[model samples]
Target: MYKHILLASDGSENAVRAAKEAVKIASCTQDSVIDVIYVVDFDKSKSDVLHSGSSEAIDIERRKKNSKVIQFLNDANVNYKTTILHGKPGPEIVKYANDKKVDLVIIGSRGLNALQEMVLGSVSHKVMKRVNCPALIVK
Candidate 1:
């Protein structure tokens, strides 16, 4: 019965699965909106320009990741919006969800190895700890 759902995607297979699940949730909740966010780690990019080809690259990647979800939402007549943020994925997602007051946060598991996750800390794990609302993590 969530009125607003946030879907965080990084264009991975697990992310696509999470998008599909968010779409399904949106379709079932009347007057609900699905907010999709893709975070770009601009700080990590070696490119010096802020508004250069990197912007284009981000747009292309967003479109590629969002097309299927958008199509499904359109077919289901669900309302949705997308946003691109520049920051670390976990913190960005948590901030967006809180700022937008989303009722739920749905994200994909990065499928990192246990040792890698222990060392690097997966985004989903961070979101789960930081988000105020409920979070659904899809693997």
Candidate 2:
């Protein structure tokens, strides 16, 4: 029933599982499109660290994170597109979902930012509170 599925990943195991689940859900409809998003949350210190690094280093990190979801989508042969954006993960994801008018948002409960997560809770929780669509969070 989902026309557009948004899968948010950060190269985490939980995110990979979420991606796989999104793929399974999309498999039911040939016309469904899967959009994978990896947000570089500027609110986190981890992002500050990435910013301090060289541009090549930053691209390498982004590529590494994107690869996890990309590999799964490739193997599944799902019609999909990937996006890498910089912003606070929760709001950025919610905004993208709203802009795309996605039917479902699939995201991991935990991401790469452990310290900020403990202080502010997970991005998935924030996304759930913000997004208008159905959100499936994989722990």
Candidate 3:
């Protein structure tokens, strides 16, 4: 029933799981499409600049990080497109979901400790709170 599904990925193990879930959901409908989002936060950008040899290398490394998610989607033979956004992960994901008016959002959970989550506020928590649509958090 959901025609537009948004998936937020960080290239983590949980994110790969989320990709699989997205594929499953998208497959439920004939016209469903999965929109994968990967955010490049300022901290990561800074670190990449500092450590990488060139911008081309940074781009390559970023793609490497997202390879698993892409691979899963491709192997599943699903209709999906990955968009790279530059900003805080939570806010960027929320913004995209809102602007696109997606029917559902699937994101990976990092499973942070209580104290760590309370302090840092996991991105999944933030997106779930702010997004208008139903959100599925994959652990």
Candidate 4:
């Protein structure tokens, strides 16, 4: 029943798996289009002057991740538009979905334990709280 699906991929294995599943569902639906988003979390660089090396390293890594997401779509033969947003991941994803009027969101959950998740708040959880559209969180 989904007409416009928004899939968030961060180049992680879990995200790749979620993308494949989302694609399969879109294929079944026949007329649906997938919108891919990769959020570049710039918040990690706030105090970057003290850690310039780490900041630069993270920027490079983010670029590589973005490239991987694009490559994955190309390999799958999926025609999709992509966005590289600078901000916190959750807000950016939710905002993009709302802005695009997407009917559904497919996001990957790495299934981190409570302690790990507390230390690094889960993007899926934050996006779920903010977005009104139905979200399918793939573990």
Candidate 5:
């Protein structure tokens, strides 16, 4: 019975899987509300800017990336709101989950940046370790 669920998404395949899991879990309780967060990685944002040519373009691309998850929740009748945050994904998601006092945090095991995850670590790993609530990392 998780009343407050936080889903950290990066629009990757695994993220869609996580979104599915979030919907299933959130549906378990009538009062559940999901907080979807798409954190724009600072380093990746620079690359996106260079490829996109403008901030507005970048925003559009971001929305397009996350649209599937949003649409899925809508079709499933799950109550959720998405917030876009600009920062390092791991820290940003952790801060948001803790600050919002969510009861559950769900995220994909991997993200859009596979090389970065191999080089440094995964955003899901960081979130699972730091969140104040139960963290569900979907593979």
Candidate 6:
């Protein structure tokens, strides 16, 4: 029954599954729009390690991933829009939902246990706590 659905993706397989689910839900509802967001978190150490040879390569790869996600939406013929943001994944996702006044959010859960979640905070947990909108978490 969601009018505007916000789906967060990290280009992971789990996220991709969530995207497919969101699209299916949207297809059943009339006048519904799906918003897909990809967050690019800036980790200097990770960036340095990954981009040892060239930073341009990293940028190109990021763009390619973003393009692939957008292409998937187009190929599916789903009414959707894509947003690429730079920030911590959880907060950025929550903020975008609130700012856009989305009816619901569909997120992928990494299936982290309490201990693992405590050590490395899960994005789904953080967004659940912070987001005012309803969330449908997919595994």
User: What is the alpha-carbon lDDT of model 1 when measured against the actual structure?
Assistant: 0.83
The 0-to-1 C-alpha lDDT of every candidate, in the order given, reads: 0.83, 0.85, 0.92, 0.81, 0.89, 0.83
* Model 4 TM-score, all chains together: 0.79
Residue range 1-139, candidate 6, lDDT tens digits:
8889998988777777788888889999988999988888876438645765676776667657666556667777888977878789999999999998899999989998989999999998788788888888998
What lDDT would candidate 5 get against the real structure?
0.89
Better of 1 and 4 by lDDT: 1
Tens digit of per-residue lDDT, candidate 5, span 22-60:
999998899899999998877886689789878899889
Worst 10 residues of 3 by lDDT: 41-50
Candidate 5: TM-score? 0.85
Instruction: Please provide, for model 3 over 1-139, each residue's C-alpha lDDT reduced to its tens digit, 9 standing for 90 to 100.
Output: 8999999999988999999888888998998989989999987878889999998998889989999999888889999988889999999999999999999999999999999999999999999999999999998
Candidate 6 lDDT:
0.83
- For candidate 2, the per-residue lDDT at 98 reads 91
The better-scoring model by TM-score among 5 and 6 is: 5
Q: How many pairs collide in each candidate, listed in order?
A: 0, 0, 0, 0, 0, 0
Off by over 4 Å in 6: 44-60, 66-71
TM-score of each: 0.82, 0.81, 0.91, 0.79, 0.85, 0.81
Question: Which prediction has more favorable TM-score, 1 or 4?
Answer: 1
lDDT of 2 by residue, 1-139 (tens): 9979999988778888999899889999879998888888776547646575777777776777678778888998989988887888888999999998899999987654777877977788889989999999887
Candidate 2 lDDT at 37 equals 89
Regions more than 4 Å wrong, model 2: 43-60, 111-118
lDDT of 3: 0.92
Supply the TM-score for candidate 1. 0.82
- Enumerate residue pairs that collide in model 5: none
Model 5 lowest lDDT segment of ten: 109-118
